[model samples]
Target chain A: MKAVRTIAELREQIGEMKAASAKATIGLVPTMGYLHQGHASLIRAAKVKTDIVVVSIFVNPIQFGPGEDFETYPRDEARDLAAAEAAGADLVFLPSVDTMYPKPTKTKIAVSEVTSGLCGASRPGHFDGVTTVVGKLFHIVQPDYAFFGMKDAQQVAVIEQMVYDLNFNVTIVPCPIIREEDGLALSSRNVYLSPEERTQALVLSRSLRETKEAVKTGQIRTAGEAKELLTQIIGESPLAVIDYVEIANFPELSPLAAETAILEQEESVLMALAVKFGKTRLIDNCLIQPKGE
Target chain B: MKAVRTIAELREQIGEMKAASAKATIGLVPTMGYLHQGHASLIRAAKVKTDIVVVSIFVNPIQFGPGEDFETYPRDEARDLAAAEAAGADLVFLPSVDTMYPKPTKTKIAVSEVTSGLCGASRPGHFDGVTTVVGKLFHIVQPDYAFFGMKDAQQVAVIEQMVYDLNFNVTIVPCPIIREEDGLALSSRNVYLSPEERTQALVLSRSLRETKEAVKTGQIRTAGEAKELLTQIIGESPLAVIDYVEIANFPELSPLAAETAILEQEESVLMALAVKFGKTRLIDNCLIQPKGE
Candidate 1:
């Protein structure tokens, strides 16, 4: 398990690997270092789908909001590499800030509708950071496929849109979320919890699952009811401050008003939620569908 | 020269060419069809510097203004090929509007400071179109080097800034402007002119010569004086409606003001002018330097 520290080093290794085997498809799993099962799931998915899997570990500064975890984002390089190796990744790239952006880069990819609505509304310039850094990673790795965790569903959507729009010629594969035994979404920020905050954070994932169940069993009338129930669930946790609970349709990401949208689009009312536990903002979601369809 | 009509075909040809010789270096000259000495000059420059020169002939629709010549841009494949082969181009790409765009492309590249001034101020969304289409062309060709005519001087500067800011690895080579015996800048739009309009269009080039003479003879004191003389020169032509005549710092594209910008920077100032003759707008420029420097 060798750790590559620079963009040049990663590019050289990938180029050599490409020369050795013409059919050696590369799969990239981008991460912000502190590894958990959610990231582990993404690595494993990439490993299974491609000939070589490269995991990038960078605590991206641009994506962090001013009041957010820019400074305190957890990083454990050794642990991350060990976990990546355990999950069957062939290479681990840990680039310095200079390695990622030596100078100010002006090029950015933006998705108009999908980006402006969800997390983008809360974290200004956050998706811009995600898009820019992912673009740099995509260029450096030159991967055949890039795997992303659906925990940040908006991020996955943005990257997919950017890839399609930019003609990058790389496949964007979205992997599923890996949760705790309590149905709490696994995140590196979970460690920031003071046991009580950890417990409060579970409300986000739990309410989402409850909303899914409500929709599944015909307990909810419209998307509005599910939204109300999810709000109430988080309100029960005193320490949990909910930011937003949105049910948006697939790809278009428009707010789900009823079971159907205009244009007879294949609508997906993703029950997405965001809640703050202490200083850290955690996010989670579950898909809800109409009873018959 | 082998013409590739689609990106798929071009990519396949590139694969075979790369396999045959790893030492082969690809150069690209992107142009709209009706090839002239200007296009040929770029192609010839590409042939000298790289092993494989691919000339793309697609009149980009995005770059044309609403009432501009998008509908009337010239095309003649046989004539273009004869010019391309004579100039030593190895591959000629003549993709259709569908092949180049396929659909409405969402991705775009923008250079803030450089593009906002110059022709950008007049042609709304023009440089955006150039940046977007050239980006796609670079992706498709994946050339080692790309060539452009300095006749579209602002376009060269915009692309240079974009390539630098975006970390695109291709070397940008700016070729000298190709002109007719009478000093009019060669352009595909020249074909649209009546003989009288064609002769009147010579004012665009002649104004630059006047500015050059004024600066050389120490008669011009400031940018205003130079532009005023140009306005007078174009006013002499009955059909020529003067658009703009100004000198500016090369990459910055800032007007050469006596109070603000130092005379030292005037060495890099580009004297660019645009004129309209009964509908067709023509642009040209001359690079200025300080006297005895």
Candidate 2:
């Protein structure tokens, strides 16, 4: 496995790799460092699908809002490199902040409508940062397939929308959300949570699981009912401060009416949540398919 | 020469071309077809530099303002194909409006500061539309070098900024502005001018040429003096209506102070003009370098 820090070096390595094998396909797993099980899952999935698996580790500063964890976000290059190599990444792009952004970026890629809610609403300019960095990665890697985890559900949707709208010559392969045995979605930020707060974060996944079950059992037919169930379950945890409990049509991310029968809709429904446990804000979601498809 | 309409067919053809040649470089010339000398110049330039030269003729409607001539924009596919082929283009991608935009694009690529003045001030959402479409073309063609005519000087700057900020793996090649014997810059919109209006349009280029001569002769020292000279020369035409005659720093497109010494600045000075002859609007510019090395 090889690790590169500069774009020029990465391109040179990629060029050599391509020259070696005419039909080799590249897969990119973009991430912030301090790799968790979720990130490894993406890298491992890339290994299966592509001839060259590149894992990018950079805690993009622009994505964090003014008051957000830009300074304190986790970073462990050694651990991340080892985990990526173990998960079968052929190359690791570990660029410093300056290497990624020599100067402040004046260009921004914005996806509207879908980005107007959920995490986008709570944290402004966040999706713009994600799309811009991801765009840079896409150009730098020029991968055949770019893997993203559904753990950042809204991010996946926004990026997919950008790819579709921009005609980027790459495919977006969304991997499933990786979670702990107790059903808590794996996140690098989970390290930020206190032991007590860690336990409370599980309510996020539990509420989503129960809501999915409720929809399957025909108990929660309407978006309003699902929101209510989610709120009720999450409210039981004292440390869980709900930022948003949203039910939107999947992919399109348009809001469903409160009384709309979500189960009867043709599109898949996304039940998403954002809860603050102390200073750390964590999100999780589930996609519920329509009945009798 | 080959011509393709659908993106899928274009991609397939490009893939085959790449497979056949180990290190084939693609150069793209993006245009709204009415095959003027300017566009032909770009295609011919591409032929010299690249293994594959693709000329994309797209009349992107989104760039036109409400009162602008999007619907009335001239297109001659049969003529354009022949011109492109004659100019040494290997392929011409002539996608229909629907093929380029299946739906109204939700994604937008915006470059701030650089797009805030000049034509950007006159036409709202114009640069956004240009950048978005150009970005799409860059992705669709995946060219190693993308060419743009400096006739739209601000456009070249804006796209360069976008490419720099987004880290697009494409080099922007800004071709010299092609002009007629009378010094009128070539443009597809030249077809919209009436015979008298076309005659009056000579003032746009004439003023820019005179201004360049003035700067060279040490007659014009300040931006204000340059603008005054430009206005004086162009005002000689009775049918000409002055839209904007301004001087600014080149590439950056930042406004130069009226008192700023035109020939003393470290950066290249740009004297740009936009004049209307009856209902037709025309633009032209001249770039002046600083004092001798």
Specify the highest-lDDT model's number. Answer: 2
Models 1 onward score TM values of 0.90, 0.98
Q: Which candidate wins on TM-score?
A: 2
Worst 10 residues of 1 chain B by lDDT: B258-267
Off by over 4 Å in 2: none
Model 1 bad stretches (over 4 Å): A1-6, A76-92, A259-268, A288-293, B213-225, B260-263, B289-293
For candidate 2, lDDT tens digit of each residue in B1-293? Answer: 99999999999899899889969999999999999889989998999999999999999998999999998889899999999999999989999999989988999999999998889988889999999999999999999999999989999999999999999999999999999999889988888899988888998888888888888888878998998999999989999988888898988988899899988899998899888887888999989988722
Q: Is model 1 an incorrect, acceptable, medium or high docking prediction?
A: acceptable
What is candidate 2's DockQ? 0.92
Report the poorest 10 consecutive residues by lDDT, candidate 2 chain A: A284-293
* lDDT per model vs. reference: 0.81, 0.92
